[model samples]
Structure formats: structure tokens, C-alpha cells
Target chain A: MLLSGDPPRGRILSAMLATIVAVLAVAPFLFPSTRALAVAERIAILIVLTASYDMLLGYTGIVSFAHTMFFGMGAYGVAIALTRFGAGWGQVVIGALAGMLLAIVVAAIVGLLSLRVRAIFFAMITLAVASFAQILASTMRDWTGGEDGLTFEVPKTLTSAFRLGGGYNGNLVTYYLIFTVAAVLFLFLLRVVNSPMGRVLQAIRENEFRAEALGLRTLWYRTLAGAIAAAAASLAGSLLALQLRYTGPDATLSFSLMVDILLIVVIGGMGTLYGAIVGATIMTMAQYYLQPAMGGLANAFSGVPLMQAVLDPDRWLLWLGLLFIAIVYFFPTGIVGRLRTP
Target chain B: MSEVLLELRGVETRVGRYQILHGVDFAARRGRVTMLLGRNGAGKTTTLRTIMGLWRAGAGSITFAGRRIEALGTPEIARLGIAYVPETMGIFSQLTVRENLLLATGRDGLASDRLDRLFALFPALRERYSVPAGVLSGGQKQMLAIGRAIIEPRSLLVVDEPTKGLAPHVIEVLIEVFRRLKQSETTILLVEQNFRMAVSVGDDVAVMDDGRIVHAGSMADLAADEALQHRLLGLSLAVHQ
Candidate 1:
């Protein structure tokens, strides 16, 4: 029921999903290192963020370059609230709510104003809007802390110093909080994509003209999808801010983050919500470990200058890009798509 | 006499710089099949698009069930009980055959009886119900398109070139399907290049030339007279056969 009757078909894909979920569930205990826990936390947050992006780009066929803008709204909302009102549960709740509300309103306005245009034009509009939001965040030094960004305290319960009995600590609590929320949000997205309304979204995505002829007011549905995606992305941002205890344009509103989300969506699979979990896990782990692995490889190839240079840790991004290209070439429909196909 | 279910008077439509429909006038009588016949580039498709409000009529009025609909948006016009099947067939290729019809139902879920009736009409759809529509053959896709239109009991059905590019037997199947629909008194506006199919299923006929209706009469009169057909369509039903 959580999946709304849409199951992750294929034994390989099902096994992979189960393994990822299981690993994340007990990640802190399995890999107790601070860096490892951090990687796990990042994966959790990215799952929610990428899945929200999938709601727009994959399901609704909306290509928005401003997803990071909504994400930034949430991060900045929490950061500013904590800085101004001081850290508390009440401030966190209020900030997150405000950010989601703003994201929804802005997303709706953008959708209504520009969604009637062709896809490319709408994408450009979102890009411009996102750039403007980034600039606004950077220029507003008084409230936003400017380009320097902001770091603030969370509730005492989430801090590392607060430890429970039997070696349990607030870090574990924070991780669990994020993990639980991500799981709930992920299921929520799955439910939405498999619902009757989600079917209409897919129909519109496939052919807008036919959908309208079917008596569906497509613009309204598109706007609703955009608003909902923004709300979810906003929540994801809030989680990120809570986990890192910091918020900045580069962290939440960066164009690079948007590109990362896009890559994950494509690599995992478009239009498949389950793809988000797979994509985020793979991508985040690679981002954390690939460079180190490349360094090890580079050291092994040190005897050969060309091989060493090619395998240098700094060139991890090049390898990542090549890997992405390979995945796309081999699995054009994406990993999940390839797996789902009979 | 059956009343006009849909009427277009001086409905002019422009696509960017080119005017596709110029003062087009025609009517689809209730409980009858109105065949819109034309050669290529005669604005047959454009007229159908205008009727469905896919294209805004730049001038004149389009009345459906005595309501002026030229100003309405496509969805609003569609909500008024008109189902349009475009020449492209407009099948949502990514969706399963069942999902495609499910979307058209506009309900929470598909009614079993309606689906059963659809399966009876197009048994291939039932066999491939769970398969993506993209993989279906051309004829099956056409059947799916018509099936989607009639999935629910719509008041008027507008279809464009249902027999285009299909084989003889497939065309025969479609003709039979339309005849069955005709017996049910479902008002239909059909566009076709195949005169034989038009002659077999059409009740009222409207012929378009250079973006305007050049002839409007009963299909029997047009079918019975070859000279009139040659003058209007540049070919007779016998020649097409």
C-alpha cells in the first residue's frame, strides 16, 4: 500500500533496493566512523531531494532549473530563523513551514506564468529565476550572512555532545530523524506517482494535447506538480540544514547541486520514483569514495607517469563524468529502466 | 430531422502566419456520422482541431449543443462531452493500454463493465492490456485511439483519418466498428481520405477545399452521383475502391 500497488519489479532491482535500505538503516552501527556516518546522512537527504526533482522532471515532464532555489529557501529559512530567533524546536518547525509555503507559492507563480510556453523556454525561465534567487541570497548580507553563509545551533537533542545511555548519542538521533523523514517522504512520493492523479500527470507528460482533449486541465495539473515538488525539495533542504548545522548558497542553491540532481535522476531512471533511492545512494557514495579510491589507484600506478596522472585523485570528476556517460550509453533508459525491461 | 449537435459558421483559424481554415462552415447532426472529406492541405485536420478548440478560431462562431465554444479552452470544450481522436492517434506511448484508457475515464478507477465492453470491441486491447501502447502495431494503436474516445459514453466523437495508412482488412474492421457506433446513435464527426470507408459509414457529408466547406449534403446523394464526387473530391468512390 505504501507503494500504491507499484512494486519495484525485477529480482536484481529489488535486491539492490533492499540492500541499500538495510545498509542505511544500520549505517552508524556498521560504519561508526564520523566520515562514514556523514556519507550515510548525505545519502538519506539526497534521496528525498532527488526524488522531489523526479516528481517534476520525470513524472510531470517539467524541466525546472530552479529546484535548488526552493531547496535554498528551506535551508535559508532554517538558518535565518536559528540565527535570529535562536535555536529551538519551535523555530525549526516554523522555519520549515514558512520555507515550504514560500516554495509552493513561488513555484505556482512560475508555473502559471511560464508553463504555457514550450519546454525549453520554461526551463530557461526557471534558470533565470534561480539565478536571481541566488544573487538575492548573496547580496542580502544582513539576513543571509552574505557569501560567507551561516552556521547555527540545532536543538540540544540533535547536537553530538548530547549522549543517551548505552553509547547512543544525539548524532544517532539526528541520523534517525533524517532517515525516518526521508523514508516517509520517499513513500509519499511513491504513493503520489502511482495514484490516479499521477496517471494523469504521466498522460500529460506523454502528450499534452491528448491530455487536454481528455478534459484534463493540464496547466493546473502541471502547476500542482511543480508546487508539490517544490514543497518536498524545501523539506529536503531543511533536513540538510539540520544535518550539517550549516546553510549556504553553494550548499543548497548552487547550480552544481541542480546538475547533480539531474544526473542522479537520469542515471537512476526517469519517471521511476524508486530510481531516486538507487541513484542518490550510488552517486553520494561515489562522490565520497571515488576520489580516495582513485588516489589509491594513482599510487599503484606511480611507477608509470602517464597512468599515475590519468588516475590522479583530482581527476575523479573526469572519471565520474566518464562513468556517467558509460551508464547512459549502456543503459539509455537508466539503470532502473534497464532492469525493469523484460 | 436530427438536430445539429455541432455547428461551425465562418470559423477562421490561423496557425502563425498562415490561415489554415478560412470561413469554414459545417455541422454534425445528432445521432449521425458526419464525414469531413478533403484532399491533402484542404484544412480537414485544421477544421477538426478548431472544433476541438486545439486551435483558437480567429473569426466566427463554433456552437456545440447550442453553446458557443469558439472562445472556450480545449479542456473546457472537451468537458462538454466531445471526445477528439487526432490524426496522430495521440496514444500515450509510455502508458500501458489499460492506463491509457484509465486516464480518459476521468474517474478514480476504470469501471469493469465499461472495460469489458471496450475489450469486446477491441479484443487485441484486452490481450495487450498491460503492455505499453508504444509497442502496439499501427492498426492496434488506431483501435486503441478510438477505444479511448468511446471508453465512456461521450455525446459527440470527432475522429481524424481513422483509416489512414491502415490495411484493407483493418479498414474493414474500423468501418464495421463505426457502423456499430452509428446504430447506437453516437454523433460522430470523421475526417477521411478513403472514399470507400467514408461512403460505407458516413451519414452526412461535408467536403473541404482550400480551407472552406465546398459541399454539404447527405452521403447517399454524394455516393450515388459520381460526377459530383469527382468534381468535389477529384475522385469517385468507385475510383477509390
Candidate 2:
């Protein structure tokens, strides 16, 4: 039982978590770099997305490839509202709510369609649905802006690089906003997983037939988890659109983005909530800094053709592939899970 | 004897293309331990599954508390006050024993008095209450599974092979536990391969073979007649005794 797990260890974990949050809050002042803040914001948004995904894959034991579909819905929700409705901050809230509702409906439909099948078939169904959604986004040029995507202005206060008085200005406000949202969403997810309902989710994950024998309506619980996860993912999607002031299929709905989420979950530890945040930080930092750093190494090894090719910035995926291999080989339980084991 | 708590009349079940239960008729009277005994592939498990609505009955009917439940889902059947301990001992291995028991109960969770009673019956579970069930020994895991079933009071309890692969001492403990539970008000339908334990615990007996009940009678009748046991079970009860 979560209530009975090592109390001292739990205390240490909470302390560690508090330290991490404090450091993140003061990071902007400590670094004072725009590029750093941008990277941190990106990680913040992804933390919400991946944590939501964990609710399905980790807690509920449902491997879904259509997570990006909900994320895209959130982004497009805000994008469409601003571009066509000439929406303000109030409309932003309306867009998020609409996106969440849409996500619940779509997730329920998809879950009903695919839940009849087993794991691999469910994954395939979600993939097919995600691809179809991507195509729909591309073809519906009228609403989605098609392949070119949509760029729109947010409220002047949010977009202004520098405001004179107490109004928010520059990267600091956006970064803090992103951080606050991510933190709140992460805590919400944590609360859900710790609750008695969450315990049922884990029980279903471990053995659905058994859970049912205990009188749990497993399908309904799993469906509820899907709706909750989808809603949170859409929230992240909306934040991403706000952060970039742009929306596109490739950016939001791509299967590659889902794969990135999978990588973050696996590398950080699939079921652990905070692992998502830790993973987002590690992976985003790698993406931002790995290529250029590897480029410098590539030049150093230019004399050796093979070494230079392997170290090339364009081939940074090779290094990432190796990193993935190393993580799986050494830490199969995941970083956070491994920390908890001892 | 009390009225029939569960009655399966002419029940037939098909899993995919193959039919597993063929018009099987069975009943568990109130406050009695009805043992369904058979060799492997005898459809004993299927009969229990049909009663639980894990497999839909293609024909005939299963009546629980005077209501037809042949068309209900597994959860619906479970909600009708039946607790099942599957053959695999269906403990959530990743969860702690206490969590497994907690999930068995809903919002209020296990009452302290009820928990203390269960702990007294199986003290090993109390010691390993916080440990993940996967780490618990096999006997302890079996205890946890049975503990989960009794976490909430139910009208009927169904168990499949509760003592399978257990040590003699552990089996002895379980046999006593079942005896004590039989003293309680709940009706029990048990599927078991070990005839010794069956003879000890069961009040009524049904011998199944190839998806049908070949013989049904009082456990006293079955136990007293070694010739009948030899003819049906391919081993005399005297030999094991």
C-alpha cells in the first residue's frame, strides 16, 4: 500500500522534490539567459504532456499512440480561437475548455473502438487514428491552415518583449507562467495516482481480470483515466501553442512527438510521476545542447572519417540512440524507479 | 439444508469455436461448502467462470438469489455479492498486500476489526503487509489472495485450487481457515484437485469429467465409498488416506 511504503524514504523523496522545485523557480535569475529560459519552458510544457501520457501507459497499462492527437487538439483549439474568433485571454480559457471536452469525446470513441482488442492491436488502432487525425489537420486547410500551419498573436501583455509598469514582459513572464502551469498539472496528476481510484488503476494494470473479480468496473475506470489523461495532454498542447504563438501538424500531431514522449517515459521510469519531469529536463537539454556540442567534437575528429561522421550534428540521433541503449541496458527500471528501489 | 444460493441448469459455454461447458447442471446450497472436483480439462474452472459470467452461457441459465445472471458481465456478477479467487491466485503482484486488500474494498476500505480477524487467521500477511506481493513467498501470496476475497463480506465465495502447490503446513492452515469460514454464513463453491483436502472441507461433492458432472452427492457418501472413488477418480480414497 502507498500508505505503508517506507515513511523515511518517502520523506527523503518529498524533500528532494521540494529542492528541485525551488531550484526551478529561481533558475531564471540564476541563469538570466533567454535561450536557457526557452529550453526550460519547452521542458515545462513537455512535463505536462508526458505526465498525462503516463496516466494511460503507466498507471492504467494502456499503450496509446494517439496521445499527440489530444495534444494537437489543444494547440489547434487556442490557434483557431485566436486566429478566427479574434480571441483574448478569456478566449484562451474557452479554447482550453473546448479542447479538453473534444479530447474526452475523441479519447472515449477511440477507447471504445480499440479496447475490444489486446495491447498491440490497441497500439495499432491508436496509430492509425493519429495518422488519420494528422491527415485531417493537413486537408482541412480552411480550419487548420493545412500544411503551412497557423501563426497568431496572443494578448499584447503576454507578447510584449518589455512592458513599462507592472505588466508582464520578456521571456521571464512566459517562463514563469509555463513553470506554474506545469507544476500545477504535475501535482494534479500526482494526486490522482495516489488516490484510492488510482490504486484501482494500478490494480487493473497488474491484472484486469482480477480487478473485475473484485467488482471493479475496469473498462469504465480505464475510460475515465483516458479522458483525464487526454484533457491534461490537451492543456499542455494549448500551452505549447501559447508559448510559440504558432501551431502545425508536424509540431503538435506528429508520431515523432509521441515517440519522444515514449522515450521520456521509459528513460525516466514509466510509472513514476516525477520521472516525467526529470525526463523532460534531461531529453530537452540533450536536444538543445547535444548537437552543437557534438558538432565541435566532430570537427576535432575530422581527421578520422568514421568518427567524424558518427559525431556529426546532423547525426545526433546516433548519439541519442546510444544513450537510449545505455539507459535500457543499465537502468531498465528507469532513473526514478531505480532511485526508489534501494 | 438451506435453499440453493446458486443454481446452474443446463448451462453450456463456448470459448471461440470450442465449447468448454456442455449443459452442466450444478447448485450450491446456502451455508455449505460445495466442492467441484475433477482432473485437468474437466471444465471445473469453466463452470466457475460461467457462474461468475467471465464466459457467457450459450444456453441454459445461472440463477443467483432467484435472479438470472447468465447474460451479465463479470463485474456485474461480482457486484451481486460473489467473490472469486482465480486459480492463478490473482494477487496484484506489484502492489503491497495491504493495497491489494484495500482495492478489494471500496471507499471505506477494510474495517479494523475485519482486518484484525483476517490477520489472526493468516499472521504471515500481517508481517508482510507493506511488502510488495511479488516479493512474498508463494504460501503468503495465496493467503493474500484469499484475504482479498474475504476483505468484504459476500453472499458467496468461489475459489479455484487455493492449495495448489502449497506446502503441507500451509495447506493445513488453509484447511482450518476454510473450516472456520464454513462456520460463518457465506456459501462456498470450491474447485480443487486434492481429494484429501476436498474430503476434509467439502459438505457436498460434484465429480466432473470432460465438461459435465458425472456424479453429485454428499461428501460423506463419496468419502465412505472407496470403490466409487476408484471408479470415478482413478485412485481410491483409501490409498491416499
DockQ of each: 0.84, 0.80
CAPRI class of candidate 2: high
Model 2 ranges off by over 4 Å: A1-20, A162-170, A298-310
Clashing pairs in 2: none
Residue-by-residue lDDT tens digits, candidate 1, A199-241: 9899988889999998999999999999989999999999999
- Give per-residue lDDT, candidate 1, residue A186: 90
**Highest TM-score scorer:** 1
Per-residue lDDT of model 2, residues B1-241, tens digit only:
6899999899999999999888899899999999999889999999998888888899999999999999998998999999999999999988888889998888636799989989988999999998999999888999999998998889999999999999999999999999989988668999988888898889999999889999999999999998898888887777766
Per-residue lDDT of model 1, residues B1-241, tens digit only: 9998999999999999999998999889999999999889999999989988898999999999999999999999999999999999999998899888988888777888888888887888999999999999999999999999999989999999999899988999999999989999999999998899899999999999999999999999999999999899889778777
lDDT of 1 at A119: 100
Q: After superposition, how far is residue A337 of candidate 2 from its true place, in Å?
A: 2.0
Q: What TM-score would each prediction reach against the true structure? A: 0.98, 0.95
